[model samples]
Target: MDTPPRVPGLGTFLDKNTGTPKPPTPQLVTVASRLLLLAAVVQVVASVIAVVYAASPARLDAIQLQIDAMTGSTPSLAMMRNLGILTVVISGIATITAYVLFALFLAKGRSWARVAAGVLALLTVMQLLGITLPEGLTTVAQIVLGAVAVGLCYLPGPNHFFATVKAARS
Candidate 1:
């Protein structure tokens, strides 16, 4: 029988005789891609929701009243509403970038993608601790949800989920 191809840097990861670096198994890539796609979908939905709220004056006033009551802030409702909307927009951009990079990493095996994912995971934890923990009950629920998001990304489905993509690429 004929021999398989060889990958230059992989040594014998896939029989040394095989000439192409074995592409990341399709199943793993698909899992990672889907995670990223799901994140993108959630972010887009949230952005749409924010846009709806931003456009509705009555909705904005109601939200502002609640916030003002809670924080004892005397600022006008319009200012508070603008701040909230701006936060949503900024978060949307960051979310889109994260999902896009994650999908790209799964497909192309970029090292930076691995680093970025790890950093994002850590940020998720920090945000939970820094912003959520102090707020109690509702914040606790948000922290749990954030933890799940980070946890899912590192699970076994995403081939070498926590490993160095550069090494795999090589």
Candidate 2:
């Protein structure tokens, strides 16, 4: 009796009948991809809201008041506003990059992407907290969507999907 060929470093064997990689990606992973994409969109919206509201004079004054209360020193409004803009732009870029890039890799059935996405989901919440008021709606949407998206990948079906891909690729 002959055994199937094996990929290096993977416990998975080639399909006995086809002598190739495993089957196509499962539906759960596909849904995860879509959910992640939706979350990415919401993040983009929230970033725009942050830029708009974080730049407002009243918002800056409110932030200044908080800073004064905490540190007892007030910086110039222009400096504070510039810092806010820089923070938003850098964070927004990083968040969106992680969401979209990891989602794509997850869709492709990358095993590492599954773990990376979980980390991204957690980190994303920290960023969402910085969103300005009224942007809270989008932030909440991202939380829900991102939670569900990452959760789905850990389901049995997706696990199998990822394992097959791993064994096949490895």
- What C-alpha lDDT does candidate 2 achieve relative to the native structure? 0.79
TM-score of each: 0.51, 0.77
- State how far residue 18 of model 1 sits from its true place (Å): 17
Tens digits of per-residue lDDT for model 1, 1-170:
99877657554222333454545544555555555556566557656666666758777879767876875547777777778788879987887678676666545544345456556545544544544232333334333433444444456654363343435434
Which RMSD values do the candidates have, in order? 9.8, 7.0
Backbone steric clashes in candidate 1, count: 7
Worst 10 residues of 1 by lDDT: 132-141
* lDDT for residue 127 in candidate 1, whole number 0-100: 45
TM-score of 1: 0.51
Count of backbone clashes for each model? Answer: 7, 0
